[model samples]
Target chain A: MKRIFTPAFLLLTAQSFAQDIKPEMADSFRSSGKIYVVVCVAAIVLTGLLVYLITIDRKVSKLERDLKSLDKTSN
Target chain B: MNIKKNWWKAITCVLLFYTVIEGFLGAVPARDILNETIRNLYFHVPMWFGMMTLLFISVIYGIKHLHNGAMRSDLIAREAAHTGVIMGVLGLITGSLWARYTWGTWWTQDTKLNGAAITMLIYFAYFILRGSVEDEQKRARLSAVYSIFAFVMMIVFVMILPRMEDSLHPGNGGNPAFSKYDLDSKMRLVFYPAVLGWVLLGVWIMSVRIRIASISEALLNHSDTHPTS
Candidate 1:
């Protein structure tokens, strides 16, 4: 299969390079695109925490709804 | 800035923004193995600091629960411990990643690492102990009692035992700590704010959980009084 590299993918690839203050110091990570892997891993960790927080938030919102219904019934 | 409701939260947001931007962009010491990985200090080490602060808050609430027999205190303690455990796990993951990059190993039998694992184990047991009891008051009292004991053990394992050994981590076996080594002024600026940001975030999570728990308990009480409700 001939793979067509879209502009979006190419942009991502370009930005994946190391944000090195010393360009000479980051020979491998910059050239080999390894820094993006670290960025991706960090993003995954943050996403996991965010998902957990969202789940809890939704659960609380649901319970609050249930409580509101119970209040109506009691009234 | 409303100090009671939103000030700290706003500060947390700003600090976190600064941490994410400056943490990556900031200059770090060019050392041998930890050349670039030193930046992990902002993320990994702050997790430990935030976890420690949350756990300390948990123990304080535990003590308060025991003293006043306040169920709210117990709820806060439980939620704080829960959030602290999550933060601690994150710290362990980040530390492991940093270690793998710097030391060529994901895990080591280092005293500090072992202490961290043991401390995590103790807190995990605390949650399990909370789950074992169905009765509310009994659960609260026993959990409070055990939390105090677990915290003391945690202090011994994490603080004392690690110091008694030669650690690859900083500030062990008479080695100078981070401040003495590479915690230069530039790093400190981001590092302190990162710690505060994470700890505030932990507290925010705990507060939200506590609110939900209280509401659920209220609902349960209402149902007990009115069968239809």
Candidate 2:
């Protein structure tokens, strides 16, 4: 919740200094709050996937050790 | 599983990055109710597509298991089915959120939504069925058969039944699908790649899971042979 508001709040506050968007132009709502919603969802999903990849990497390393031990015993 | 890894993962990453930046930042059909919420289609719809594709692949692998009797095939099928469910859950969550804003309800008694829930429930049962059996080979065989049957039922729920009844979803009853919604070429450009990116990412995750399963199976075999000193 904080993450969502912080950026938007900052944008809202910083809107005056940001002269590039145009003085008479874009409406405050059209500045894309809904887009932020999409971004938040995407970020959450990607973070979850990244954590999953870390787990898989650890499992693969453990399996490699197990295989190494088995080969040593055979020798 | 043999062969050097190439650019596919790289492509998946790039495509997804493009989808996110382009999907949200890009312009959309600004109609009443839909407004900017239409952007959810790129993320939410692709999740369903990826889940369906993985489920289809899992069923294929399940059939292959029946024919060849390899534990590897069964493992692949299981991993695919399990990983596919992750995407299905994501789809359901995003869809529900999108629905809440658009339809004034987080859920409805719509036929398409009900069918989707049933599809998810059927896959959850697949995992539970996998867990119940004690014998390895018997579990493999039964899981394979169940997955194949489940896949057919999934088609019924996901594809056929919804079309036959009224649905709050598109492409059902008289509602317009993405095609009929005047999804211009610009949106299609991002939407298509978004689907491909998600499906490829599912493949990547499932492949990693299968690799781990294979390794664990090998370790089990090693212990059985030598009694792990």
Candidate 3:
């Protein structure tokens, strides 16, 4: 499938590459685009883990309730 | 109606607002040698400071929890460790970015960088250690001990590593700490608040997470006592 690159994606990519950083020395601060991808993915994964932890609290309560009801019925 | 509980949230919001404003202002103007790169110091150094602050608090809580078996202190310790990890991640990211611009590499085996990386790895193991144990009391006890160990290791790594080896980083190998020549009065103006604001923000985030954990714990306990079925 031929995927078209939309203007939005292009803008986002451009913005990420863009920086106002000036080097302390004469060296270029340019990083490989791949490194940026890796770091961004890591940040996203960490955020997702936090979201998952937040949601899991609900299921934990539900399980506890089920256990209590089972005990009640047995007794 | 609930005013006292909201203080931390209010503080969080204010600190975040200040971070953004200070960060932006850090960008607007600067002299030579610093220029835009100085802005990275505002974010990077503050994160390191916050990470250390959280870890130190965690160690204190750990000591209290172990000595007295106070669940609240244990909870505080766990939350502080989690917040420390988050700040550690931020520091690494910002430092790596700063390095990419200044050193032309995403990473180098310099003394400070190595020390920072090792400290990060040690905290990553903190979570692993927690997960390996299942008994609530045992997990808390073991993690508390380990947290103190990790905190000490962190300090040693930061303080001792740079001195033992030479590095391109500013303050290493006989280089004077807090050199006014490297860090001028203008930089200091932004630097101090940057550290304080970020440390407060880290604490605020940890407090929110801890409250959520406590509420969730209560909800679980309630379900155990009263079943819906």
Candidate 4:
């Protein structure tokens, strides 16, 4: 009984929390502080992508090594 | 090879150098009402122009795809659309912030704002439409048609609607744009470079994004043939 009530309470808490914030609140926030938010978000997103691009250079070297190993095994 | 390399690098560097100089000079006093937010105009306007330029390129690719039914054209169209969406979003955000500081409100329901929003929403819908469809060919074909329609609508809404109505936004009918208040040789120096810097930056970002998308596509295709356990 306690387990079932606990799960039900958690679900209700999640739904209630979700209902507390209106979509318009986010829109208002965006309108009010768009420049700062955009700059921050763009910097974060671009940094992540740039880092990913950089890692691909490493992956290419690994692939080259693997291919050389494969040729040696075949020989 | 040296010449070609230098040419691309030169074009990029010249633009960057100019933008840095202009951006620096822009910090100096403006003899107009625009104030500090006016500095954003140099960055913001060029982004909007770049967005328009990219959207036009997207339309060209869309038309070519329709004519040839080639996947490569579809890829180009998709890349251009993606880039346009980014620039458009940036333009809207910067414009809105500038408005809040200058007009004392984040939004005014002004004709230009409404038009810009509509234009962004139209392109946004293209992405949603593309996502909803499953067949690659059908998705490409339908999105191309929609993009062309959207491009036409965007021009009408942004360029025409503002002119037809009374707008607080400058550059509307009878409203003086940058030209009306003489660009002054000083501003022009910074203005041109800002345009080039921003446009080159947009292209650089877009190329990186496109390369990432292509790699993801290749990986997906590779996995499809060699099912992983």
Best by DockQ: 2
Instruction: Identify the candidate with maximal lDDT.
Output: 2
| lDDT agreement of model 3 with the native | 0.70
- Candidate 3 Cα misplacement greater than 4 A, ranges: A1-75, B1-19, B26-34, B176-178, B181-183
| Residues A1-75, model 2: lDDT tens digits | 546655664565476556544333223443545546666787678767756665775677677787888779785
Give the clashing pairs for model 3: none
The models' CA-based lDDT, in order, is: 0.78, 0.81, 0.70, 0.71
TM-score of chain B of each: 0.95, 0.96, 0.87, 0.88
TM-score of each: 0.79, 0.82, 0.69, 0.71
| Candidate 2 chain B weakest lDDT stretch, 10 residues | B1-10
State candidate 2's TM-score.
Answer: 0.82
Tens digits of per-residue lDDT for model 4, B78-187: 88889988999999998898888778889998899999999999999999999999999999999999999999999998889999877889888667776644356666
DockQ of prediction 3: 0.04
Docking class of 3: incorrect
Model 3, span B6-92: residue lDDT tens: 465445445445555544332233335454575666678889889999999899999999999988888888889899989998898
Q: Rank the candidates by DockQ, best first.
A: 2, 1, 3, 4
What TM-score would chain A of each candidate receive against the reference chain A? 0.59, 0.55, 0.40, 0.45
- Among residues 3 or more apart in sequence or in different chains, the pairs in candidate 1 whose N, CA or C atoms overlap within 3 Å are none
lDDT of 1: 0.78
Alpha-carbon deviation at B214 in model 1, angstroms? 1.4
Residue B229 of model 3 has an lDDT of 31
